[model samples]
Target: MNTPSVELADQVARAARYLRPHIQRSALEGKRELPTPCADFDVHRLSEHLLGSLVAGARAAAKEPLPADAPTTLTEPPWVVFPPLLDSLAAAWAEPGAWKGEALFAGSVRPASFAGTITIMELTVHGWDLATAAGRTFTTDDDVIATATAVAAQIAEGARARGIFGPEAEPAPDAAPLERLLALTGRKSL
Candidate 1:
């Protein structure tokens, strides 16, 4: 973390609003079996993962113990909790010590700032997954994309070799910021 000019928490909130439309639409469509760009997740399953990720992020930011992984989707629709869940993540990170030192991640320790970056990337990348599944466009502010791009590159430096992400496809040098962000994360083709 180079100490971004725009706070990571702020960008997380804005990215949610930008992606909210697509998420709402996909949920409303009720096409649980529809395929998304994320190969392993279908609409319903991805929605469940989205909900879990939201919960995980908020907990991580608050320095709370992360809930154990579950094989369940949310029993009720997530619309009610989704917004506040994202807001909670942002709110927690806005606190003074949220990004300092280390945070717990699924029973292990990780750098808080790096975990925060992963939180943002989850929303940006998976938000795109939801959008693409719903046949919607995925566009957010350049600030969000730029921060995400930088963060993804940093994470990929270590994780790419572990197959945490597929080999990244290059994007054109002049491509839109979001496109580059996606490309660097193994989500877009040049």
Candidate 2:
């Protein structure tokens, strides 16, 4: 049987393939403002943040030293950064053995594998953010959604206990597993 981490990685790859084309064609209006689920970020900033996270995760998975000037704040569009970032992510995931159970950086509380899961969550949610900001819609494969749904259900259980979601935000009555996944992660739609 596949480990949950491996399964989540596969789901993430599927979501990334589904998202890559849309990300490439997305018109990232540099100066124009657009809202995002991440409170401090507008569209451009969020894209940059996503790319930065991807880069970090990829590097960590490779067991490489992080760049000295790694971005601390969001700055660029995903379109400009995703190609290399995605390549790194693919390489990291394709590597043999388990890196997820390893520690992330010097002082992370969670294992590197959990960090990978968070990266997957970030990609899925940010893909939704990009599409929403661009006035477009995107969908994931059902298999990916099923896996994501399982992950999201676990997250939602913890988030609910911690009161992380807002009162106005509720999972739709008949939301698909992916939709619920997104909703649990603070994205309104799938």
Candidate 3:
């Protein structure tokens, strides 16, 4: 990671830890065929994508090659089994220079700056998707939101063009941070 980007990158880990439980209990789980907050992915599709990306994100953080495909679901209580995976991810990135350079993702050598921010985008927005599908609340401190928003602003348009995020839908003038974050990612908060 770029020196200044380290702090924001760390936020991705925090967001992941914060959202894991809600993902475990997501109402969208097991209903793999329903629509999600994102226009392209339905519940089942997003769930699978989320699971695979968790594994991939860890790999990216570790400076390892991301596998072509990752699994969408686990037996149960991944909160217990998945910690090691997350631990590996955290540990990989914990290295002094883990974020020092560009990382491989989906067969592409993405810029160093993209590694953490994209992870934050995927986890935070998809976590919100799961939480919303479950009729739950997803909260974050101002700093996390700031980092997420900043990352969104940096790459959201590119993501949209690449068919990652949906088309931009502006948020209300007075929308809160989380709401602004969601809208930037093309998910309406309301």
Measured by TM-score, the strongest candidate is: 1
lDDT of 3 at 91: 63
How accurate locally is residue 29 in candidate 2, as Cα lDDT from 0 to 100?
49
As for candidate 1, its clashing pairs are: none
Tell me the tens digit of each residue's lDDT in model 2 across 15-74.
677668656734564533777655456777777667677777776666665687876554
Q: lDDT scores for all predictions?
A: 0.73, 0.63, 0.70
Which pairs of residues collide in candidate 3?
Answer: 1-99, 1-100, 32-44
Off by over 4 Å in 2: 1-6, 29-32, 72-76, 98-100, 105-109, 149-168
Model 2 local distance difference test score? 0.63
The local lDDT score (0 to 100) that residue 142 gets in candidate 3 is 70
Error of 2 at 153 (Å): 4.6
TM-score of each predicted structure versus truth: 0.85, 0.76, 0.82
Give the C-alpha lDDT of model 1: 0.73
Worst 10 residues of 1 by lDDT: 69-78
What's the ranking of the predictions by lDDT, best on top? Answer: 1, 3, 2
Each candidate's clash count: 0, 1, 3
lDDT (tens digit, per residue) of candidate 1 on 18-61: 76776664454676787887656787788888887777777777
